[model samples]
Target: MTTRINAVPRAVPAEEVEVPFADCYITTAAQHAALRVLRSGWLTTGREVAAFEAEFAGYVGAGHAVAVSSCTQGIELALRSFGLPRGSLVLTSTMTFCGAVQAIVHAGLQPVLVDVDAGTGMPTPATVRDAVRAYGPPAAMTVVHWAGDLADVPALAEAAGLTLDQIVVDAAHALGTSAGTTPIGSQCAATCFSFYATKNLPLGEGGMVTTNDPERSRWLHQARLHGMTADAWRRYLPGGSWRYDVAEAGLKANMTDLQAAMGRAQLTHLPAWQHRRAQIAARYDTLLAAQPGIALPHRPALGTGTHAWHLYPVRLAPGIDRDEVIAELAQRRVGTSVHFIPVHQLTYFARIASVPPAGMAGADTLFGQLLSLPIHPRLTDGQIDAVCAALADATHRQFTRKGAS
Candidate 1:
């Protein structure tokens, strides 16, 4: 028998518990690391950044890692490293952060927005194949590890008949996620991770690109800092040369020592943080199991992989106004968010798109009902219960309203 939290509707009280949709977890070690960087004379990309790259590479089992200012820059640099022709189509999911699509565009590549699996909100092998059939074969693809769930890149590539080198992964939410025994960063040509404030590894602003190809890694290292052969750290440091060559035009996207120091410190606490996130997700599963008019997050089968639990999104039943439910939850002092509003539906992308998107029904359907609840290391058991209770009451009100209408 499964345990369930009772969902009884009640009037809103003056002191309802407050639950934020997301929060950053910063350890004391991270704070100390930041202070140490401040005290050091060298603040730009230097020893700290190098150490963070090596540690991150080792953690993800990647051959090489290059630190960047943001995941968006990492993806752009990764795509540019491919040297694909201008206007080359890069297949990517519509249900992702705009940064992924923006990266492709910044690389001078056209983004072919592919539909995702309605159930998982991730593009599967079949979806990739469908996109290929509709848009012709793309030069490459950017696979997003949605909501901390790792997509099967090898299988998707094999099904689409593309080489591993043709795949770039947006692992913004999947720092600790793995597919079977393989970690996320090691599966593709280049995998990018975000250390954004609200991410699993909160470093305010930092990203890393992991690749097994040495040549690509070397290219990214230069590409991140204006294509210079050497950076200021090398030029101004002792026994350093000011003479350098600009091999190619690149963006200013290097990660600073301060961010890297914090990243290194936060990496140490990732395991414990991930464990707590899992526990919160399990507690949500138990509490919300019996609630009506809502669907829980999809859990991958046992042994397939581990989720990072960055976001816990539930889908509301059909005909319930998702916005109204969100408002209701806010009234009850519970915060929530929608994962995304399909990229194709965005005003800018839609107006710029040359052709209409095909096979977007899945993405369209999923976007309407998606609602992300609070799920982070800081969430306590009582908070989880409060979130559930608020959600239950809010949805019940929506259902009742719909029935009456």
Candidate 2:
């Protein structure tokens, strides 16, 4: 008679150390394309760049897409394309990256900051109108897609009573995002996208400027390469003219062929990657909602568009210090981060709004409560479970019985 074998019970392996957030989804296709770019002798501003630009332009539903060095540069170029007068009033949300502020300043425009919605972290259309009215006629309004959530850009543009020339979108966080039926890049005069390593669709460090105006598009193409009338390759190529003209002092901000190769590969897989992002976001919503003090982000009821889900920032209970919460979470080996510290809260914005820390209630309050958990696509089910459990423990640790630590 054969003895039946019994399986021995084993430890659950300590949940595999939970998970780390923000894994870049580079595929085999990307690797192959990168290798191909290396093999191809002509690397800088080659056919790869054109192919990637065209593909991206089509994807974003824009007439032109100018690949640049970084999103910040794209924003600057967008502003500069208008050829705005120095000190022209420009309005943007106060709750934004420092790059937006710098873009305005660098373009020789005066930034007139406006407050964002307390809950949504977006500038309301009314606020845009009011800011423009108060600050005098704005040369342009740069609406950021905060947290990969598209602001009410079309409505804000409409309220300004200005042409599309007056609308530029700092869509650094909005690659595969859309506002209503139109994609994020299609709604404004110029739309800038970042491919920073941490960004949703990363290309190490690169950016794109999509626009409808042919003149603006041409200017951007030239501007990214020392304002040269022709590309360097064209100038140096066999049977090419030695002479060229530099009309303006343009910034050196061109995307290399290698970066374009990576971008092209990323773009091919962006749809699928974004699909996983949405799935992860939904999972966060379901699991995190059970925590009593956590507040979730709200999508517009009327908008029929895809949220890129680049960030999954949840607001913690008021009165609970966010730093303490983060520290406790870190002690539990949970990876967490904050979206931003508002622009006005920085020392530089003191001149624009001398609002005290307490008075800048909207931003200060939000900063103290927001926490971004691990929501990357690489997360496994068990890891996700562990993170949720860790969060619960942290929350309970912070808010339990008489608010004892």
Best by TM-score: 1
lDDT of 1 at 248: 87
For residue 22, model 2's alpha carbon misses the true position, in angstroms, by 1.5
- Across 1-405, the per-residue lDDT of candidate 1 in tens digits comes to 112222343444423667888777677888888899999988999999999999999999999999999999999999999999999988888899988889999899998888888989988787788888877888998888899986878877776678888999999989878888777898789999999988999887889999999999999999999999999998998899999999888999999999999899889888878888898899899999899988988766799998888888899888878998889788877889999999988998776543334558888999998999998777767778888888888888877877788
Model 2 agreement with the true structure over 156-206: per-residue lDDT tens digits: 777766676788898887876786777888767899999897777877789
Residue 143 alpha-carbon offset, candidate 1, angstroms: 0.4
Give the range of the ten consecutive residues with the poorest summed lDDT in model 1.
1-10
Q: How big is the RMSD of model 2?
A: 5.8
Q: Report how far residue 76 has shifted in candidate 2, in Å.
A: 0.2
